[model samples]
Target chain A: MEKLTIIKVGGKIVEEADTLNQLLDNFSALPGYKLLVHGGGRSATKLAAQLGIESQMVNGRRITDAETLKVVTMVYGGLVNKNIVAGLQAKGVNAIGLTGADLNVIRSVKRPVKDVDYGFVGDVEAVNGEMLASLIHQNIVPVMAPLTHDGKGNMLNTNADTIAGETAKALAKLFDVTLVYCFEKKGVLRDADDDDSVIPVITPELFRQYVVEGVIQGGMIPKLENSFSAVEAGVSRVIITLASAINQDAGTVIKK
Target chain B: MEKLTIIKVGGKIVEEADTLNQLLDNFSALPGYKLLVHGGGRSATKLAAQLGIESQMVNGRRITDAETLKVVTMVYGGLVNKNIVAGLQAKGVNAIGLTGADLNVIRSVKRPVKDVDYGFVGDVEAVNGEMLASLIHQNIVPVMAPLTHDGKGNMLNTNADTIAGETAKALAKLFDVTLVYCFEKKGVLRDADDDDSVIPVITPELFRQYVVEGVIQGGMIPKLENSFSAVEAGVSRVIITLASAINQDAGTVIKK
Candidate 1:
């Protein structure tokens, strides 16, 4: 059974208490065939501002300077992780929120930048699928946050999409499930303004064409890249869709 | 295979970082099996004071009023939990910190006082052995903190020792391990002042005899009670010893 659905949830999708609860409810009713990876970028940025600290971003990823790293670690791995775990458990989802730091489930090498070395941000190097599959096999849904550690014992800020991709590939190698990428938008679209123009399917060539034609750019770039990575890494199928479309079948499917 | 070990660590264990690190380094390397259950009572008390809130205690248990509950939950379950997890992981120990609120591993029943209601303090009613054994079997140490919730979704302040006892009982039903209740004292003794007079062993009858004779009084009473409870629940053995003796074989072993 080498199949799994890796679902990546964006912070915006979980902004309100009701939305988070509703999402968990939909997830609980899901066919017990998916794993979830979550992002908390907006929440971390907002909290850092409230705490009077400036968050630095290089490209779309956070530049984890010491101060910013601490805030994000505490918020992403601690506060938001637990809240999501509690929320899903409240909805009878049997969710366990874990960080890459736990069980050394995900490991990485720390990336230091000019003068300002990020005290604890690492680029993920490995994913421990055995540990994760054991939990999922026992009927527990994992709610993973975007954080990993250097194998040498330092924490790091990682891209949630990348984490989800790696996790999808890992789970795909381990079980039979689906990989779902959930965001605020209503799936991939041919026309950005028309929500009804959802792309039903995508191929690697179509993806490149869409990017060059300006139909898929910005956030969609990394997501598509992640989807392609998962597909390449043995995940049989990948879904790029909206959270609202979880119970429906309106998301774009990427498969061989 | 009804064997179990319950190790109780105090909040002061983390307050003294160097000493705590040394202890963790030694404890993590111990040859036999073990599980660590910890208390953050002192931190909860201190944070409650700093917040200008009145702290309440009943029979040495912190009465978890709403404000105090919030402080303890954030400090113990968040900061303290992560600190220990980080420390253990740093030492190459695969320690996973869990709250009773997570996975419903340790469930409780709210025990509000007759006259004055303690907002969220509970007495242990159940322990999910299947969930625990799965983790332990995978070689991941379960580092439990005493913040649980009733199944109805309300949080509760549970006694750390009680949680440890229930956990030991659960593990005892699945594996052969000793339950060591470590604290500040060298060991339970006939006389309080003589550290050298550490009681080597005691049976259920002898423990009762000591209590009736006014030998085991005050703080030792609850610990002894927890020990006896674990013994009755099929744990292979119980020991009341100091944290410093974790690496050493110096402790009072309580047997069936």
Candidate 2:
């Protein structure tokens, strides 16, 4: 099987011009087949505020109301995604921007109302790996926006990490998939205050030990969990690292 | 050669839900390979006003300064494009949204300043017909946004009509292409005041005569010129018609 790298970057790295340029440079230089899944929540929030739409959040997760969904769609699928595609094109990479609805690559169900009504949010139901592999074979690098559809004309806000993990898991069947979660941090740290105290490798047992030791807490917990899940689902490797270090071997590698 | 239909729709038709749904229904019912080029200027203007960004227009063309470019990107590439893609998917059409920058499908030069500087505005230099044909062969209907790139990092505001015309012209080499311009009007009218006075069949000589006489004036001039250009470029036909009449074969058909 051919090796494919699936990189998921957060809004901060992609929002600014300089960082995004650097990130794209690294991404363009990456070997073999590649796909990018991105988040633009910060931009969405800012634009929502500018539009005077109140953003609602519950337990650190966004409550994507109708207006908020529109903002996210514009930011993630439009502004940020296009910028990346254009940048990569400038660098001679054949990057194509997409939402889950495009080609029906990802089908998601609207999250049912339970304790909280996360309006217009979607939990992914399927990732069409065959269609994606077809695109990859044609050398088209898909820049996926963190948006999914219910196959009934409704676009839903989705989590970028989940998109990356789910996409990696699905593609793992056809390729040697490596899912990389790129952000501002160097890697998972041994001490919260020390940036140099990066943990080079982590197994399932090590991940549990780190969680019990309180070194990995909050948002990082769910991210790491998603990474482990990808590894368990037959993905070859999962890396959590800085966006700038994408081409380098300088991140916490997760394995089964 | 296989027949391909390229439809260009105005922003007004896509801005509202009712009209958009109707247009999508009409579009979905069309036969053979199809592509859609759309405008979202109204949505951009609305979002710009809400964000306190003053939209500057010179002679009915937008001055795409940095701020206005962001607004347009968000509106056209993000909100409008995604909605159409998701809607088409709901109707079981394998639709993918694209800008010129995606896959380097359309490469343009930044419009040079002479009388006025239209910042970030691009004049298309080339269209990659082969790449488009590849996607079309895979049964993916592309929903194009009115955006292009300069083969550099810059994303430029382009005209929807121009995109549609250029794409049709390029695809003409591989497919028997029919370019359709759908708007509120029924067709190119003989009488400006009467909607029923549509000129049914317009040849190049008749088009020139209409322009010489005062029947074809203002915006209709350039539209007709584009239509004639498409015919010259080997496109099988160019139809200017109402959005609802797409599948009905009711419109002004331009021929050599």
Candidate 3:
């Protein structure tokens, strides 16, 4: 199987001109088949505020009302995604910007209201990995936006991390998949206060141990859980790293 | 050669749900390989206003200053384009939305400063028809947005009519291409004021005579000229028609 690197970048690195340029530069230099899954939450929030639409978040998870979904669709699917595609094109990468809706690549069901209705949020049910693998085989790099669709005619706001994990798990059948989750920190740190204390490798056991030790509490818990799930679900590896160091081997590598 | 239909729909039809559904229904029922190029000028303008950005139009052509360009990118590339893709997907047509920047399908040069600096407007220069025809052959319908790139990291506002025409001409080399321009009117009319006055068939000589007789004045002139140019450039036929009447053979057909 051919090697495929799926990098999931967050909003902060891609929303600004300088960081985007640098990120693209680094991304463009990667070898073999590559796919990018990107999030534009900050841009969406900023645009929503500009348009006088209030963004609601519960437990740090966005409550995607109809208007909020539109903001994300515009920001993630439109502005940020296209910019990345255009930037990669300028550097000679044959990049295609896509939401999960494009080509019916990923289909999701709308989140059924539990405690709160996530108006237009989608929980991905399936990913057409064969379709994506076919595109990658043709040397077309996919720059994905964190947006999905209900089989019915509706675009849904989706989490980028989930997209990356789901896509990686699907494509793992066809390729040697490495899913990279980029964040502000270098890696999962041993000491929360010390940014330089990067944990080089983590296994399923280490993950549980870290949580029990209170070293990997808070949001990092779920991120690593997804990473472990992806790896166990057939993805060869999952790395949590800084966006700038994607090409470098300087991140917490999750192993099964 | 296999048949290919390229339809260019303007903003007015697509910006609304009722008309968009009607148009999509008409489009999805069409036979053979099909592509759609769409404009979202109205949506872009509305979004700009909502964002507190002033839209400038010089002689009815938008002056795409920086802020306006961002609005268009969000509206055209994001909101309008994704909605169309998702709509088509719901109708069981595997559609992928694209800007020219995607796959480097179209490359344009920024309109140079003439009497008017049109900001980030682009003039169509090249179309990668081979690549597009391949996608069509694979049963992938491309829903194109009215956006192009300069091959230098910038998305430029482009005319959907030109995108449709250029794509048709390029694909004509590989397929029996029919380019359809959908407007408010049924087709090129003998009487500009009469909705039922569709000419049905128009040759270059007839077009010239219509212009001489003042029947083809105003914006209709450039539109017909472009249709004629597409025919001359190798497009098999060019049809000017209403969006609702796409599947029906009820439009003025341009021939060599």
Top candidate when judged by lDDT against the true structure? 2
Top-scoring candidate (TM-score): 3
lDDT of 3 by residue, B130-229 (tens): 8898789899999999999999999999988888988898898999999999978889888878989999899999988888999889998888888889
Clashing pairs in 3: none
lDDT of 1: 0.75
lDDT (tens digit, per residue) of candidate 2 on B1-256: 9999999999999989998999999999999999999999999999999988898999788999999999999999999999999999999999999999998989999999999999999999999999999999988999999999999888999999899999999999999999999967899999989999989999989988998999999999888888899999999999999998999879899999
lDDT of 1 by residue, B211-256 (tens): 8999889978877887878888888888778887877888899898
lDDT of 1 by residue, A1-256 (tens): 7445567888877656677777777776677556778878887897668657788776666767676765666567655666667666666767676778777778877875666555466777889998898877777778887887664545678888888878877777777657888866677888888987888898899898898999988878877787787788888878877886687787898876
**Worst ten in a row by lDDT for model 3 chain B:** B52-61
- List the candidate numbers ranked by lDDT, top first: 2, 3, 1
**C-alpha lDDT of all candidate models, in order:** 0.75, 0.93, 0.92
TM-score of 1: 0.86
| lDDT (10s digit) by residue, model 3, range A21-124 | 99999999999999999988898999999989998998777899888988898899889999999999999999999898999999999999999887899999
Q: DockQ of candidates 1 onward, in order?
A: 0.32, 0.91, 0.92
Model 3 DockQ class: high
**Cα lDDT for residue A25, candidate 2:** 93
